[model samples]
Each structure stands twice: as C-alpha cells, then as structure tokens.
Target chain A: MTLLITVFAAVTVTIIWYKNAPDTSMQLGTLSLMFWGASIMWFVDAVVGYMEEGASFFMQDAAEMLNDLYLGLSVVALGLIIWLVILMIKDPHRVIRSLITGTNRQ
Target chain B: MACFLVPASEAVITTVAEKIIRSKEKNDDSNNASSVPKVRFSDKLGWLNKMLWGGSALLAFEHIWHGEVIPVFPFLTAVQNGETGEMLAEMGTAGVGMAVLVTLIWGGMLAASHVIENRKVDISSEEAGQ
Candidate 1:
C-alpha cells in the first residue's frame, strides 16, 4: 500500500514534468525524482516481503496495513523535506540572496 | 594494493570537492545577474511547495497520534495491536484521494503557467510591432 501511494505520486509528478519539460524548473524535476526513487525502493521492499511471506503477505491485517500507510506517508514527507532543503540551497529565484542583502523588496 | 587504492580514492575525493567549491563560487557571482525572475512569497510554486509541506506535517502528526512510528519499524509487521477493518479501509481511501487531489492541482498549475507564458509572448510581440 505504501508502494502504491508513492508510485501514484511519482507517476503524477512525472506526467506534469513531461508536459512542461521546456519551461519547468529543476524543483519539479527534483520532486519527481525523489518520489520515483522512493517508489523504486518500496517496490524492492515489497518484492522481498512477498518472497519471504508468500501468499500470507497479501493477507495483511488491518494494523499492519495502517502501519504501512504511516510509513509510506513518512517517506513522502521525508522526500518533500529533502526537496525543500535542495530548493533552499539552489535559491533559484534569488530570494535567499535578496534576504541576505536586505534588498528583497526593491 | 591497499595503500595505492586509499591514496587514489583520497585524490579523487579532493578533486571532486575542489570542483564543487569552485562551481559554487562561480554560481554565487553569477546569481546577481540571473535571468530568472525573483520569486515572491506569494508565488504559485512557492504556495504549492508549502501546501506539500503542510500535508506532510499533517501526515506525520497522524502517524504520531496513532503511535505507528515509535516502537519498531512501521513499514514491517512490528506492532501487535490491530485496528478495525473499517478504519483500514478509510485510510486507504483517504491516501488515494490525497494523491489524486495533489496531482490534479499540479496539472492545473502546469496548464495555467503555459497559458500565462503564451500571453506574455503575445504581448511582447505586440509591443515590438508597435
């Protein structure tokens, strides 16, 4: 379920990035890449889990599913946090620069 | 062999670090004359990023509220307590719904930006003609 959520997010972001490829900035690309990376990681995790648990894996109880959901959301949140840090570092539009120079409003 | 590998790796690391530092300095100089427009606090992309962060915070809070993150690996079957099946169903629904909503917003933004760019181009061409 966590894998599914991340995959959906990744696909959605990728489609948006694709449609606006020429004009879109690196931030969007960064977002897409992060989600896609998480999805791939979760995919491997799911595969390993299934291999170990076999058919029982599909029959997860409600609590386990809920836990997976939380974990999935955490991963999504972590990815966004990383992206935020990247945006701060890049400061593409010079917002940070302006702030530092105290000439932001001009 | 070990000594050779270690020094070779150190040299590679040092070269990469120097390159990164040089590029960062160059970027700092060029940033003053960057072509990209300055971002305002009310920028649409900025709003979107904020919204994403807000959602993430809410999810984190939810995880904490349910105690799904403390004792063990939440991704695996670590917790022994079980939840109602209905609650599980609702969570699944909500998760998918949130994903869909976010995607729709991003798509809308993309379309809006494209239209805005085209209009700007048209206006510029008109000014040039005049």
Candidate 2:
C-alpha cells in the first residue's frame, strides 16, 4: 500500500517537474527524485515481503493498510516541507534576498 | 523491523563519501570552449545520498508508526518481543533488498542523465558545425 502511494506520487510529481522544466529555480526535480527513489525502495520492500509471507503479503488488515497509507502521505508531506525549505534557502528567484535588501534600504 | 537501519547506515557512508569527493573535485570543472561539460562525480554521489537518506527516513517513520521500533534500548520492538529471529530475517531480506534496489535505480538514473548530457553535446556540436 505504501509502495503504491509513493509510486503514484512519483509519477505525478515527475509530470509536474517535466512541465516546469523551464523553471529550474523551484527545485521540483529534487522532490521528484526523492519520490522516485522512495518508490524504488518500497518496491524492493514489497518484493522481499512477498517472498517472506507468500500470498498473504497482499492480505494486510484494513486498519494496517490505513495506517500505512497515512505514513505514505506523511512522507510526501515531509518531502514537500523539506523542498520548500530548500527553495526558500536557495532563493533561486532571489525573493528572500530582495525582501531583506528592500527592508534594509527602507 | 530493523530494515530501515540498513539504508540509513548506507546513507551515512555515502554522505561521507560525497564530502570527500567534493573536496577532491573542487577545481576540476574548468572546460575549454570546445569541450563538452560533464556531470561531477560528487554531484552524482550527492544524488545517491539524497535518495538513500530520504527513503530511509520515511521508512523509519513508518516503522515507528507501526510500533515496530521503539525509543528505548533494543530499539526495535521485535527484539523486545522475543522475535529476534524474525527481525533478523526481515533485516536480511527487506533491509538489504531496499538498499540494493535503490542503488540500482540510482545507477539507471545516472546512466539516463549521462546519455542526455552526451546528446546535448552532440546537438550543440552539430549546430556549431552548421
């Protein structure tokens, strides 16, 4: 379930990153890469688990699936927050820098 | 239960490797006008580090949420529950599997980027000739 969610996020973000390729300042590529990486990680986890638990690997409890889904979403949200921080620190558009400069001038 | 630790530890190694590589490549990026620019090894290593660290972090969080890991000693709950054998088996399988797969994926990504970089160089050369 977590793997599926991450794969979904990875695909969605990859598309957005591609569309926004003209603007590299936002660093959406980093977010996209992180999601893709996580998806691959979870893919392996799923495979290993299937080997261990056989067909029952997919037969997780509803409550357990819900918890995993929340975890997946939380990971996505955390990634977004980290990316936002990077964007602010990068100030690729110089937004923060200009703001500070303008305030200093005033 | 302890699967996330494997990738997390791998992340630490790669992080240190990136630092060393970065220091070594501090002044090697100067390309002549006719030269085709190439990606830095350090930057590629950085990308790998990011992947491992990001995935491991989220996996750890997920494990914690499931109560598979705890804050106290013998941090994995499976250890405390006398499921040591099962936990070790999981670490051997899921932990190693994730680490290997992520590295393989990063390799593919690196290859794709290298091919694109070369293609860009070829196009520019063709345009220059014209």
- Which model scores highest in TM-score? 2
Clash-forming residue pairs, model 2: none
lDDT of 2 by residue, B64-87 (tens): 877898899988889899999988
The lowest-lDDT stretch of 10 consecutive residues in candidate 1 chain B is B1-10
What are the per-model numbers of colliding residue pairs?
0, 0
* Candidate 2 DockQ vs. native: 0.64
Model 2's interface RMSD: 1.3
True contacts kept of each: 0.00, 0.53
The CA lDDT at B62 in model 1 is 39
Q: What tens-digit string does per-residue lDDT give for candidate 1 at A37-90?
A: 345433544554577689897898999898878777776677667778888889
lDDT of 1 by residue, B1-130 (tens): 0111222233345445556665665676577763333332224444344334434443444345455545464431223345445345533444434444443565577677767776777787788789
Give the CA lDDT, 0 to 100, for residue A22 in model 2: 73
